[model samples]
Target: MEPHIAFEDISKIYSNHVTTVAVEGVNFQIMPGEFISLVGRSGAGKSTLLKLLIAEERPTQGRVFFEGRDIATLDGSQEISSLRRKIGTVFQDFKLLSNKTVFENVAFAMEVAGKNDEEIAEDVPQVLELVGLSDKINNFPHELSGGEKQRVSIARALVHRPGVLVADEPTGNLDPANTFEIIRLLLKINEIGTTVVLATHNKEVINTLDRRVVSLDKGRLVKDDPRGTFIL
Candidate 1:
């Protein structure tokens, strides 16, 4: 089967004053419905790779294909925008709108995607429920706990039934209990068939993932294993 995401010999270089190579000759494929983890130390190019995947940053060389279409070949701003709709992202800091109610926050994502009132009304509630935040829909980010805020972020990400969810250090700020809750939710999402890609520094979380683990050191892929542990 063709992979949902393929990073072919990906490499990135930074230059302004002095040149720096961030990622070098990295190749990987993310399969649909798979739970995958990328582990590495600080400034190890993990974040750079994620940014490249989301098109936040362009690769200096190499290509990324999403379902066989070169990501670089996306026709225009509109096409790139549409591609993003199929991908959801959760960050270490829950990027929720401070003043919006949880329901409105999730609803806003669909609204921007041109979803009509009926669709937004029906889907937002289901996603909120999936993230265990149905009862907190009316609450603002300030009114919710850290875990609740992350759940709200997760719900917003799921509102579109994205084909893949990329969570970058999602549990970085929360305590262990809350971290585990987020991890459990990611696993649950994977079980339901959305490919999950996690980039994190937390060893315990990565070790417990029990999934395809890819370890990156500096800019190189040092390890790739089916039943991998977090050895970063």
Candidate 2:
């Protein structure tokens, strides 16, 4: 079977005055419906790898393939937009619009994708329910707890029903209890068949997962473990 996502000999370098390598010849493949974690210390190139996958930043060398097509070659905006629609991304920051209500925030994603009122109305509530934010749909970002804000972010990300969800440190700002709650929600999403790629530095969360761990060291792929732990 083919991998859902593949990084073939990928490398990224940035130069202005002094040159720095963000990722170095990293290669890995993520299968469909799998939950995987990318573990590394600060500045270990984890973010760069995700950026390459999303086409926010291109690889200085090699290619990133999603379902077989090389995303690096996707020059057209529509092509890139189409690829992004199939993948949802969550970041450490909630990235919620402070002015929009919970429902509007999630609905905004569908609206931007050209979904109509009826579709947005139906799908927004469903995804909000999935993230345990149904009752808070009318609430603004400032009116919610940290966990709730993150849930809203997740809800917005899932509004498109993406095949793959890339969460980069989704629990970074939450307390331990809330952190676990968010992780459990992610696990539930994975169980329901969304491929989840989580990049985190939390040892307890990573160790507790005991899932596939892709370890990176100074921008290089150091270890790929099926039942992996957080070892830096």
Candidate 3:
């Protein structure tokens, strides 16, 4: 079978007046249901790789394929939307809507996807329960703690039941205690068969995972360990 996601000799360069190479000749394949962590320091191209995967940034060379379709060639908005639906993303910032309640925040994902009210009602509660935020459904972003807000973000990301979830520095804003909570939640999500691509610089968090680790340094892939730790 084909890989779920593949990057073939991919490279990205940003230029206007000054030229900056974000990623160079990066190649990897993520299998279905695999839990993989991308480890790197700042400016190591981790974010560029994640952006390439979701087609937020186009490659300067080579191709990024999602389930065999080259993302660079995906020209239509409909196709891009379909691709995004299959890949959920979470960020360090909770990115919650201040005006909406927790339930509404999660439901908004499905709502914009054209899901019916009944489906949104059924799925929102279930996803919130998964993130341990069922009781906080009526709360808003300002009403929750850092960890709780992140949990709400995770719930919103999972509402569509995507095949792969990409988290970029998800624990950056949390305390150590809350960091572990979020990691455990991601692991649980991976356990139930969602492929997880976690991009983080946290040594303790990466060390604890003990899963596949791909290390990047200065826009190049440095190492890939099957049972890896965070080594710089």
* Cα misplacement distance, residue 212 of candidate 3 (Å): 0.2
Error of 3 at 170 (Å): 0.5
> For residue 180, what is the lDDT in candidate 2?
98
Q: What is the lDDT of candidate 1?
A: 0.89
Off by over 4 Å in 3: none
Predicted candidate 2 versus true structure: per-residue lDDT over 28-126, tens digit per residue: 999999999999998899889888888899899999999898997897889898888788888898899999999999998898788999999999999
RMSD each, Å: 1.1, 1.1, 1.0
Model 2: pairs clashing at backbone N, Cα or C within 3 Å = none
Give residue 161's error in model 1 in angstroms.
0.3
Residue range with the least summed lDDT across 10 consecutive positions in model 1: 77-86
Ordered by TM-score, highest first, the candidates read 3, 2, 1
Model 1, span 189-216: residue lDDT tens: 9999999999899999988878899999
Question: After superposing candidate 2, which stretches have Cα over 4 Å from the reference?
Answer: none
Q: Cα lDDT for residue 199, model 1? A: 89
Per-model TM-score, in order, reads 0.96, 0.97, 0.97
